[model samples]
Target: MSSTAITADATLPDAQPSPTSASRSVAEVLVCLPAIAADALPTVLEAIASAFPGEAVLVASSDPPANASDWPSLELIPYSNARTGVGWVLAVGDYAAAAHLAVERDARAVILLGDDTAPIDAPLLRSLADSVRTKNIDLVLPRFTLGPNDALVNSGLLYPLSRALFGADIHFPLPIDAALSTRLAQRLATSTQRLMALNQGSSLLWPVSEAAAAGLSVREIPAADIAPPAPPQDDFNALFATVAVSLFADIDAKASFWQRARGLPKRPSGQASPPPIAAIEASSEIHSMIETFHLAQDNLQEVWSLVLPPQSRLALKKLSELSPDAFVMEPDLWARIVYDFTLAFHLRTLNRNHLLGAMTPLYLAWVASHLRTVSDDPGRAARAVEITASAFETEKSYIVSRWRWPDRFNP
Candidate 1:
């Protein structure tokens, strides 16, 4: 999640404003800018300042370099929560602390950013800020256009499942960069601060779920051009476990909210456009993915049985029998498995960490099946992915039913 680099010719408006009277209420926006490489700070800072104006901006920095030191609006404070980190390599906890800072500064609009990807210009930031000011938008999330091969976990499970459950069509629910209206920011602060008090500041927070549960206004803006964030150092399994556990925990907490939510709301479809139709696996890695799935079936069948119903187990067994060259995990089957597993997680069917860990190989199986099926033109693959998401939406009733009665026999 990042913005395109700022051009040298681009200049921020330096025009300062006249002072407002003591009795006049000055409206301010909160800007949370993380430390980036030296050359990029000037452009980002200037853009933030320009977006808010002379006297109505409060910039929060964890420990900005000396180059950003001269900015008069900078509030360089050490946030303990900013120091929080999720296990392994997922370390994006800046949102919680930034929300707290926004509340402290009494800002009407608050933007939190990760150094990985940010907007280099003011217009996008202005667009988010204006939506908060005039359009009644409470949470402004950035929609990033990822490559077909990129962000597979999000493309496969996280995004689709989130959309199905929460009814917010935001592509990236936990985007590193976002703008939050005062109410939403305060809600985020409440979540993060509570985690800090419980000595779990390192735990993740789900803003989209929070907004949905509160029935607040949510909006999405395009950030397809932002350069990818700093590459993660963690490998996929640990990353999967960390993130899945966090999401499952959030779902568990918000079960009452999502279970009550009915049909998906009719709203602007802010999804990213279809990417170029090129095979993700022209030289396909289906073999390795299938191998992993096979290994899981052999070793973890007993564990999976506790979570999956007989029908799903049978589908998985059949998928297991398919040769690597002929492998295809159906979209509907995969959605059902995810739903069953989520229900199991909520029911505490087994060790939470192990439960999430077991999901990794099955996910890899889906990827293998996906790459093989889309070896031709990628348009077919995109359509298939859409079907998978639709399946999740269509199967929402199953989740609601099973969630309410975990011990009962379900399809």
Candidate 2:
């Protein structure tokens, strides 16, 4: 993930002294984990003890078979080991379980710690608590950076894309690691029931979105060495596909408002000619993305034949094949790309899994185009993804409307 764009003002106070410092007030810190490596347990607990000695640190382990007694500070919260959705750790939903824990303990502030997850410096924790207490921020989301060769797929696509579309700067993007205020935890509790109903036995949670839409103040904290150095390949792919598809489903479910909001220009009364992609770059990634774009063209051929004007279909086919390296991506092409996703979003035909699968390749194409335009910095690439996501959010009303009622009529 990219670094946050926060500049400290004189008003923003620095982190408090060590947790052991006599002057510091006792703050309740809740550490939540699914499981932990037995060997790393000692260091993790020691770090927490040293970091927040002035504050009472409570560790809640949600692992199955509920093994968590060796560590002095750690406490095991036994939850049923029943299977849930794609990412359920223990007791299914992230916010549901988390909210239950905080409510039960009457915690002032809560922190989420994943198994095998490393802790950052004490100052980082202090910063998180300060953001909530000082700014009255309800949520503190940390920006996640790649650890060496380990890259989180969501960090690349879903995180940025979702932020842009929803106008939410969710640093963690997903439920990897986060901190929530007591009030925020309560608010999440109310939603938990609803979320459970929508998809019970699921681990998906929208803490950032929930907080943002509620108009709660949010801050992003940067953390290092939080996630395991490398996630298993199977685990990574599952996460990537799940996030991608779910996002597309979300977009598709909101398509009508977006299309209407875009105010697509009417085709001229007279005939129009197809635009050329001769200027696009032909680099390897771009080339691959372009190939993927053509594949989409083939898949959507059947759908477009029914709805698109003959001229538009032909033009789009040519546009899709334009080599990314050489393609300039004319304004109209951008509009069409937005429109296509709008259609998908409205239909919700792609479940979370399939939606993500379809989007990944297309996102790669966008990245390629952005790389050709920018200097190909991964951070820059990530930001470009956000821009595309915003394009979807711009027409939120259109999407919601069409989602409620699906019709193919041009907006």
Candidate 3:
């Protein structure tokens, strides 16, 4: 857990990558890049050649410096319209463009790489392709490390925050890593209208939201110390601007749904939810996710009360008294999570920071429930998170719905 140095377990040091299976040929893998950072290119290429063996397409969004040398394995597709924003630069330069090319080539899956990352197992590429090909997965991301520091930027903050907020845990929720299936790529390409809608007030595009909403299967793999390419790290101000703008935009889009769910007055009809994805069930890892949720609620009683209704508080308390096995199985608990998020989404649109903070515990409860459903498959668990993210996006207009119509269905 130390951020200062890479753990020996981070990368598969002596583990030799297995030869890729030819039978997994139905899918193709594409790696998206920014065109600079020649230093790590060879390593990435070599990894792809060893692991994937299939056609590797490099969708280059940025111009490589004039002095750079080109390699045959790398196919540079030019996308010129990439831009940065007031506070932060968009992480992937023209990610949409890269996604389009992959779809054009009939690629089954696409791996997005920032300048600072590398693949660990060449077979990992094949595994991603094969998963999409055979198992029908929509997206597959790898567990990543940020230099020797194992930066909090990746794990402690983004990953957990994404999980708690949306209920599905996608490790690199915002970063470019790993692969996306052809279906997912196509979904992105075709969602131009919806994408623009969600991004109208912001500079960011939540691909994670779209992928999950479409009911695509998504998962994450553990890829430790493979020496990722270097990144152009943004300073605090820029990072804050990026997060704030994107978060605010998401809040805006879901304004109506949030309002309706929270028992607030509704907004205009022009607003709508982002889109919904497949429902996530608890993983079978442990008996009941509800048990853990109740424990958390009890421990954080003060915080829970700040945001939850008296009825919800009493319900959760009553649920906790039952055995762990019995808590989450209750239909009411699950209903509360969906409703709470609907309410939380509403509160966020109002820009009520205090209420948002208060909603964190309820969000955590939902995440615990989600984890319970996907505990058996790490990949499934990740996808479930992505699914929730998709739901959250479509549910954005929930705030608007509540704001314009404040009829409490319960009372």
Best by TM-score: 1
- Candidate 2 lDDT tens digits, 160-277: 4445444556645565557888888877767655545555535455565567556666677776555533333456447666555555545444333223333323334332333222
Give model 2's TM-score versus the native structure: 0.67
The candidates, ranked best first by TM-score, are 1, 2, 3
Candidate 2: Cα lDDT at 194? 57
In candidate 1 the C-alpha lDDT for residue 193 amounts to 52
Worst 10 residues of 1 by lDDT: 5-14
> Each model's RMSD to truth, in Å?
8.2, 10.8, 14.6
Distance from true location, Cα of 363 in model 3, Å:
14
CA displacement after TM-score superposition, residue 79 of candidate 3 (Å): 3.7
TM-score of 1: 0.82
**lDDT of candidate 3 over 126-228, digit per residue (tens):** 6666676677777777665443223323332344334433333576666445577766766655544344334432256555545555556667766655433
The per-residue C-alpha lDDT of model 1 at residue 358 equals 86
Q: Stretches of candidate 1 above 4 Å error? A: 1-27, 37-40, 50-55, 64-93, 116-121, 227-231, 265-284, 373-382
